[model samples]
Target: MKLLGIDLGSREVKVVVMENQEVSQQFKVSTMSFYRDYCNFTGKIVVDLKKLGVEDADIKISTGYGKNNTDLEEFETINELKAHVYGVFYQTELKNFVLLDVGGQDVKVVRVEKGLITDLELNEKCAASCGRYLENMAEVLEVPLTELAEYSQDPVELNSTCAVFSESELIGQIAEGAKLERLCAGVNYSMYKRLDPLLTKFKGKRLVISGGVAQNKAIRDYLKQDYEEVISLAEPQFNGAIGCCYYGQLTGEAENRE
Candidate 1:
């Protein structure tokens, strides 16, 4: 059976297709383009599967920030936490771990024990601890995001608590003749510092990181100091969508057995 999963994220839409419980295809589209070109708003935004190029599926599932706002015809909706947890389970096959999914505008830290969520923490009130902060800092530094993520040593201190003010502070550091690498490292380190408090409450040796920020090497390096193992998903950004597919497969199998 073919399973389809879509994650309507804040910045991008992640689509994943699975056959016989294994990933077959995965892709992403910008959130703006997805909404403007492939969706029609009639009280809720209706999605076009043909335009999305994944028209064949036995089951369809969706989860993310925009799941509630989008009308996915015949598609079942699941909460972000459940989707992410399932994604982590599918990707890492680890039953116990700490999951950290930092998205464009928010952060989620979930504690999973024996394949079930025990506790979770969310930081939606600030962009300072999210992916947007790194994007903005990269722009200010006139460097690629990948390049900015390479620095993890001797980071300059960025003392701003707000995302907007942090940009101003980063500019000030640049003017002060600080090394380019240090500035970039500072941005990554600061984000980790912000995340540290939220993670302090959760005790786990292994941390499974997903979402867009999972690609940031500097941030991952920083996290290594705290955890015994930090696992990065092969398809970090596509995790939620993959989780949906996994859920579909699980439900399908259960129904068949019943």
Candidate 2:
């Protein structure tokens, strides 16, 4: 069986296709570009599977921020949280864990037990804790994000109360003769501080992290101090869409038995 999963995020759209339960093709496009170039005159999105070079699939599933905007009736829509849960479980095989996804503009924490979602917490109103914050801080520090990561362990205190004002505060610290390394470290630590509140309420030994920010080793290392293990999927950025495909496969099997 062939399955196509689409995760329509705010900034990007991730596509993953599985042929007979194996990942055959995975690709993505900028969300704005996809809409501008792919949407037709009638306001319908025309995804070009041939352009992605994947054969037609038996099933297609959609999830994430922009899922509801698609006009396709054939696509099955799944909740983002459910997709995250299945994605993490499919990759790690851990039934009980806390999943923390720090995306470009959102933070999601989900508690999973025995393959079921038990409770969840989400932060969308704040941009300070998300990936965008890191990007902005990197720009302020005039350092590559990768280079700035090296300073995470430095003892630097950053104002974490507000996302916008934090930029000015960083500049002020520089004027006060703070080492650039310390300033960079401060940014990384501040990101961690903002995340602490969102994470402290949930207790779990295993932490499965997803989304773009999952690749930050410093952030992951900081989080590791509190968890038994901090794990990330091989395809962290594509976790949600991968989970959508995995869920589609499971649902197909269930239907076949009935």
lDDT of 2 by residue, 1-258 (tens): 999988888778888998877888898889888667654434555666666565478988888774457544457889889888888877887899999998878899999888888888899898999888988988888888888777666746776589899998898898899998788778878888889988997855888889877888778888888898898779998998999999999999999999
**Whole-model lDDT per candidate:** 0.90, 0.83
- lDDT, candidate 1, residue 115? 87
lDDT of 2: 0.83
TM-score of each candidate structure, all chains considered together: 0.97, 0.93
Window of ten residues with lowest summed lDDT in model 2: 38-47
**Alpha carbon deviation, residue 236, candidate 1 (Å):** 0.6
